[model samples]
Target: MTITINRLLLRADTADGPYGTDIVFEKGLFILRVENTHGKSTCINSIAYALGMEMALGQVTSKPPFPPSLLKNIQNENGTEIPVISSYVMLEVSNDRGQTCTLKREILGADAESIITVYESDIESISNNGRNLFIHLEGDTSRELGFYYWLAEFISWDLPLVPNNSGRESPLYPVLLFPLFFVEQKKGWSSIQATTPFHLQIIQARKRAFEFLMDMDINETVNSKAKNKKLIDDVQEKWKQIYTQLESVAIRLDGKAQGVKDAPAATFDPFKLDILIEHQGNWQSLTSALIGLRADLTQHVKASQPQVAEQKNESLLSKIRELNNIVLQEDSKYEFLLNEISFVKNQITATEVRIENLVDDKRKYEDLKKVKSFSILDDLPVLNNECPTCGREYSDHNVEIECSDDLMTLEESLEFIKSQITTFKSVLNSYKMQLDIKKIELSKLEKQIDKHGADISRLKTELYSERNVLDEESLREKIRLENQITEYEKGLVAVGDFRSTFDILHNQYKHLISLRRNFPEHGFSQKDINKLDGLKTKVVKYLSEFGFSSFDPQLLEISQDTYLPTREGFDLGFDTSASDGIRIIWSYLISLFSLREIFKTNHPGILIFDEPRQQEANKFSFTGLLKGASDAAKSGQIIFATSEEEDVLKGALEGFKYTLHSYSPSEGKILRKLNKGA
Candidate 1:
């Protein structure tokens, strides 16, 4: 991608007349040379401002970066100050495909500072015809109406989404990239990417920006790794949920599942698991106990009958009849309790669903509140329940009676929903408690009915015959054994139904494990390695030529982990001298331009420097930087604004071909009053 700034026009409408400056840039190297305090930096800042990139210079604010000359007042050619009414900056830029567009922004006017008008034509054709785009608003980097979104497309750049510090994904905004190409005078010289906005919460933004500009494959690799890790996490979460559910079911059936792991494993065996129930104070496998109980029950049924005593026969028959009546009444009560429990369970489910829906609605309202905080749509009537077309208050369609004077605002509505959720949750807990009580009562009733039936069976056996009467103790033993058998059979059925789901859970766990193993162990692809190695070579070469004197220039290396300059596994910031630090910046930035020659990059092919020579570097070293920049300019454009003396500047540029825009002492300033025709 390529971005070439063709022209910059800064205009201020004052009481006397219009006051501004118009400068046209040509291909290759261009130098803006002027005396101190001559508005050189102003011209540079105007270009960035018009492009909606001033956030790269410093903290964003409503105020513009321009001085009073273009904002509050402007001095005429006669040195008389005039009041300024309004001011705006315009910049015309073209891409590698020769598609030209002019960007205009208001500094002091009725329009908000976030607004930028993009004219499809060149600077000369900029009139009232253009599309208005906004910056500094939410979604400004990814949405259609955002200035950066349009700018990226114009430069043919497909911006990638990168991870942010909050563990969420955000687009790599143009502001982060501008620090590389447009180095402001105040803070850009301090370090490499000194003005990168950390407030945006991008994780390792400096490193990510370098990777993007160089078009490294590491970005794709990182994204892939994150996605795979998320899948694995999701799978593990599901496994835990299923395991908990199985445990709950076992507990409800008065049995416990054994040998089942709670976490996902590649070698899990579902058939190894066992469901155990306590029978007569001893824990036994549910399936084995059911078989034993059935055998005992069959033996009891086939055993020979005993003769009954002649005098006790009537009493036995009477007792059996009474026990049967009791069992029938208990059975009827049990059925009614079952119906009540079912009704409560359904109600609990419906209440839970309603709570979920309310929670979702509350989340949406919270997001809407955040959007309103940006004040982007402050003028929209819908926010206040007023019709936009007719400018009338909207009626509450949900109101069924006379409307109340009080209406719930968004905050109130959120609070109301929260309270509703709390109340419903309390109600749900109450329902659960009631259900537990009913289940316990039902279990007791079942035991009572079983006891009564056992009594009746024992009494009936006692009345079998006068000659073959069964002893009362023996008859009671047979009835007790039969009841235990019936209960064991019921438990077996419940456990069997639960065991059927284990196969599906086990398969899902194994599939997730397989997917996890398929991902690459490391994130660095071969292409990423090549780019870093190539970048390291260029940086070392540039450092050597630029007189890097902090240590052995050959020992200086670019770190693979952070992509920053380092020496012997430590950063080179505090150890390097001030002058050498400046040289490092020069080498690092220029090497980016050099890398573009060999590798395809997203760099805009444009480099701007407010002052290249900082920290009083020797003339030879400065000359080496100029020579390096001149070589880089062969493929793109590089602009430098300097206060260096004419003779000294000329000596450094003696052998380099460049464009010079000079402002002498007599020229006074870069901004001047203009005539209507001029």
Candidate 2:
């Protein structure tokens, strides 16, 4: 990507006459040489103003950066000040692909500083064709009708989105990138990338700008990591929500999820976790309990009607005997189930104790590993299996015990303990399931025995009573049981549906973990590393040429973490003198500007400096800077404004090929009244 300024036209339509200046830039090096206070800085500022980028020079506001000559009043040839009625600045720029566009902005009208007029053609044809775009407004950096968006497209730059202070994303505004190549006179020389607008709330604004300029892939890498992390968090949150819902429903059904985790894990298996309910001091699986309730409801519905005709005493006695026999059989089954449930519960308790012991042992070995890592107590007798005083094999002093060579190392022991814990947990779950089944069977048998006893009582009552009537109590009991069964069935279905989604959530969790693992370890690709290395090399070379003296130029390095120049892992600004700091800034900015020659960069191939020589840099250093700029200009353009004397400046130029636009003392000023055609 390349952006080159072809011309800057500043026009002021005043009450007396037109007062402005027009300056055209060539392909290579262009120097604006003039006396002090001759509008050199004004010309430089006009370029930014016309491009709708004055915010780079300072804070963003409605006030323009131009002098009063174009804003309030202007002086005529007779040295008389004239009031200015209106003014505007225009700049024509072209890209590497030879596409040109002229930008115009008014300074003193209704559509003042916030509006920009873009002509698809060069400055000469701007009057014939133009389209109005807006700036300094919301969405100006991204909207199609915004000037920055249009400018970015024209420059062939696909701006990347950077994170802002609000924890959201915003485009890397063009103003941020301009400071890298266009340095104003006042604050641009204060530090490296000094003109960057931090108030935009862009996090690490300088580093992000550097990455975009170098075309690094770190942004995509970071975005991918953030995206996957958000996905994982979402999956976990949803899993927790589903678990909470399942728990609520389970509680409503007089049951709870057993051995189930609230958080989703790749190792989670829904089938292994049991849902159990407790009734009459016995625990049973929810499914089994529902089945028993449904059976009871069926039996109640079958027995809801009363007999219409009287039965013989012999028939009643026969029915009562049959119910008594069923009661006896069910009571025997209930006792057997009770014994089985008791044994299983004991086993479950023992397995749980074993698992806890194994877990504690694992934790101890892990702590030992940490101690060994720190080299503390590394040669302890117990840790090395030797006696402390004699350096002999240690013994536990157990007479009947025999020592073996198959003992495990600390790491191996930790692994063994982990496996033991896992095995015991599985055993505990199995025992609990067995206990649940036996208790459920016991509950069912007890229900059967009670039902048979009730039947026998009812038969005896009928045999003694004379009057026959509808059993309204039996009907009400049947209806109540049926409604309970319906509710239990609905809860069972809901829990079942929840369990089904576990597989999907677990799969999503695993996929997100895989994506996280696949991201680059350092968040930078090989290409990004190569570009950074190249930049470091150029920066050191430029520093040497510019006579950097505060430290050894060879000690300078571009930091990968902050993307700033450093000295032996420390910041260069700490020990650098004022002049050396200026030199460092020049080297850093020039190296970035020149990178387009070697790599595919977003550098616009144009560099503008209000004053390249600052901080009272020596003549040789200034000359070296000029030469460096000249060499860089071979492929692009370098425009700088200077106030050096003619002879000294001429000496500095030496053999360089450059365009000299000079305003001598006799010329008085850069902006003057235009000649009349008549």
Candidate 3:
């Protein structure tokens, strides 16, 4: 759409110039080039106010051109201020078929005291050469499309992106993806495109841009979306995998949180996945440790039979085995101590296989960007591979840890188990060695005592024969030797160190059980211990696809068909690598994304932006941004405003299409198209 403004004219009752411009357009791209400090932003914003009630650009832009009962508040910035705003804007919307529509309006000044709500004259429209009429005012009315409704007619917008809504409105949302088309010095013009989720918003915006192209179904353009169809499908497939994984994760994860028995009524309900997922998140570590413990105990039972010590208490072993089964319960609380030697081992090969799959699935998510381009991607980046909130790098080949809760490594579990198993093996092996030595020592000791006792008996008999009488002294000495031999034999009856060895392992078994039960919130009940792997996959899938810190955690509160923002706030959704230079990016993105969406359905006759430079705003690279915005304006009509023309304005909109219009408060002139080489 080639839209133009030729020496825009605005008429003041007295000597002031006309408050409007003459705009024209043809085809889809702009024919005008905006120069630096070009006052282009103002023209854009005035155009926005001209078309809609809401602020399309920055603060002050939302205020009506005139204030209600203007005398009460009367000073500009020196603490005193008079409230004023344009009552209406006149526009001549023309189609290639030579169809033209004009709109003029009269507006009431806003309540000067009120900040909670304020609006200029709402839209008033005169269609197909009709007379000027009030759209929202009392009594004196004209049905020829109220200005506000007319604005809406040009752009049908959905708020908070009603996901459950029907038709094209479902896919619309705010975005800021202004592309740069510069006059390249060498190698022609090189386009360094953005690959981020922000593009999602752009698709929504371009959808609106397509509306003005010619009265055709813009959804047809989406068929081209099929060209990137494989990519989007892959994204969806990946998203589906992500979705399935998240759901499974919700199930497999430790159920620390309970499901809602009753939901409260509100315009919006937050998503409940986080609560369930959080519950699952809390139990992950316990799940892994239990698995290791189960493994170790099974090996113990299979490798050895109960010694005589255990045979005396078969019931004790039986009780221990019962505890082991608790770990198998769907909701059984796993707790401390000796699992039974009698219990048979169940293969949890699933956990291992799951872990491998998680590793693989996660790896695929990382490498997703490498597989394809957004063949139909028409706008700026939205979902950035890197976090726009935090400056973090994400490669196509590595899983983003911050995005998903269920995704985790065995780092903690492995570290813990390694220490435990090492000590267990050491103690078990040491006892085995000691027990063997003790058995041999007992044997040697017994034999020596037996031979010594016999020697003592012979000495006594030989001495008695020589003496030929009682021989009490010899008998006493022989008795002493015999007693000493008996004591030596008693000393060598085995130390029983094997029992001590078993006791140590028994404690480890008990400790592991205790850990799982005591930390129920973080502990997986026996039922969930086996579901850890499944839980990880699901959490990773969703988080990687859409979860975000700025994710408006309130997005989780969605319910029914409506939404009431859980918490109210504004943001300029820019990516991490964008630097401090891009803080303004989020607000711009949101405004643009929303603006674009509004443009699509209602298909507004014009677009607008107001004084957009923010405090702490770095102006570098902004010229190209404006240039792109202006080029985008060509599809319809665009206007923007700025208080200052710092160099950033020059950089942001370099080499783009736009009719340069200026607002001169000193000259009392506005909407004047700046003619170059004048």
Candidate 4:
């Protein structure tokens, strides 16, 4: 599957930041051309970071390979640091099937570790509408179902949890595939993977990733061998654990195996153990010694045991029974106290609620009395010669009625409700006090329960103390010997089982190792050789175009072992100039992207190179580099950040479909400046 990033948006929540910074790219060559020391690296790295590819930026072994802050400070006229608060990066991309997603990640905040959010929508919907219009996949935000793994799955990358050389399994994350896609300005120009050699897992992971991207048939073979090695190491560790436990027990026995040096003599050799057991007399001796110990243990058990007098035994039994009954009754009381506390709390809540209602009613009545005199005027009936309700002439009916008596009665009722509210408040306070007292009593019961538990423990230990004193030394020795003998026998069986398993695994391991040792000479088919030949021709052509003509084409070759270019069958280090070395790297990278048709690879079909002008690269050679990028852009997208002028960019991008995002000191930056009001 091919991934094409349509747009990248970065926003900073600060007055002195680029709040609405956005960069747009089409499916062709794009240049984020800026002046030297401008924000080119920042912008390119932010794009990769947003895609969960930050580990590809700098030294992978660094504590944090990427910058901690995505936002850069912009100086105001007054010269003060206006910090960016909430910073985030959002990338909108689409696959070959036209399925699109927007991956958003917060660059700042306490929840940054858990801040990845994926939205399933087209780029237009995401840009024209808002984030809420899209659908979020289920469980995407959970750590167990990571967003990185989701993206890897979407792109059809086979990421397995493989064990590294250190005997620990590490997840082959998406960043393992990013070394080919991104080039950091700092160390990316130095080496293929600027990492420590001690990091064997990372090195192996890099090779696996490269093989995956290049569509090599040996990728699965390499992974299988690594996993096999890991399994063997795990089994060996298990065997070692069993051996150490047996050795510990063997060293404590009174025999030739009574010391560390002598313990290994008891080490069971699975292959020859049965033969030795019949001829050598160790097992027979161990059996005889165990029989003697058990016989002695029986006699000691009978002789050392003492009989208690009848009177004392009865007294002790009676006391224990009494204490047991008291404990049961106290446990019942403790449960009752817990229930009582819960009931008291419920009663307090009800009383408080009742008081609140009473207060509300009193307040409403007070407001009613305050507005009553004025409301009475508005409510008075108008005198007329007609009855208002029946619409008949009022010839003899009395039309006037007074509400002064009713108002007086309403005022008296308000006063009564006010008194009721005060009474409810007093009752509520009394119930609260009672609840507090019950809580104190509950605390005291808990302490008493704990004290009684300690007493019971002491009495039980005393009851067992005399019986346990019956020649514990001899009994313990007997038990230890028996356990040791049993464990030694099991150890022998385990060793036999392991030997059987290891033999099969060892055969497979040797086969894989032999294949890997002779892989470069015999592994490749004729078709694979033809593709590598094509790749070599392309690499030489690109290198010559990039102004590296000092070396002959025959002298420069690609290493079949590493798939990297070498000079005279050696690595291209110390023999080539800095400029020539970078050119070779450029040629190799461009050729990998250009020859995808021959390999049927999953290269993502995109390239991002940050600042090709580093190491004082000649402008003419740099133009050649840009020309190669433009050529590769014909098949895939090539996006690079450069510090060249507009004239240079225009000349390099003459015969291709491309876009130039120019950044200058005066034109603000990719990030828009905040207005005065903002």
Best by lDDT: 2
Q: What are the clashing pairs of model 2?
A: 3-604
Question: In terms of lDDT, which candidate is stronger, 1 or 2?
Answer: 2
Q: Kindly state the number of residue pairs that clash in model 4.
A: 0
| Tens-digit lDDT track of model 2 for 1-678 | 778888888888876767787888898889989777888899998888887778899656647898889888888878888899999888988987879888888987889867899988987775755888999888888999998899888888898777777756788999888888889999999888888888788878888888888889997886677668768878899989988887777655556676568887658777765567664456677777778877887777776555554535555677678778878877776877888788888888888888888888888889878978876677778777798788899565455355664567778888888888888888887787677556556655666687777777777887776666565345656776778778777877876787688778898999899999989788888999999999999999999999998988888788889988998888888989999999998898889888888888888888898977888999899889988999988999999899977777778878988888888889888888766530
| Model 3: residues with Cα > 4 Å off, grouped in runs | 1-46, 52-63, 67-88, 95-98, 108-129, 132-134, 137-145, 148-607, 630-637, 643-656, 662-678
- Cα shift from native, residue 592, model 1 (Å): 0.4
Off by over 4 Å in 2: 35-38, 60-63, 67-69, 73-83, 136-144, 161-170, 198-203, 240-244, 251-263, 272-276, 282-285, 295-480, 676-678
**What ranking emerges by lDDT with the best candidate at the front?**
2, 1, 4, 3
Model 3 error, position 171 (Å): 16
Worst 10 residues of 3 by lDDT: 180-189
Per-model TM against the reference: 0.68, 0.72, 0.29, 0.58
Q: Can you tell me which runs of candidate 1 are displaced by over 4 Å?
A: 60-63, 74-83, 243-262, 272-279, 283-522
List, residue by residue over 323-352, the lDDT tens digit for candidate 1. Answer: 788888889989999999999999999989
Least accurate 10 contiguous residues by lDDT in model 4: 273-282
Between the candidate structures 2 and 3, which one is better when assessed by lDDT? 2
Model 4 TM-score, all chains together: 0.58
Judging by TM-score, tell me the better candidate of 3 and 4: 4
How do the residues 75-183 of candidate 3 rate in per-residue lDDT, one tens digit apiece? Answer: 2223333333432334444443343444333333332111111122222332243433332232211123334333322333322221111222232222211121111
- For each predicted model, how many residue pairs clash, with residues at least 3 apart or on different chains? 6, 1, 97, 0
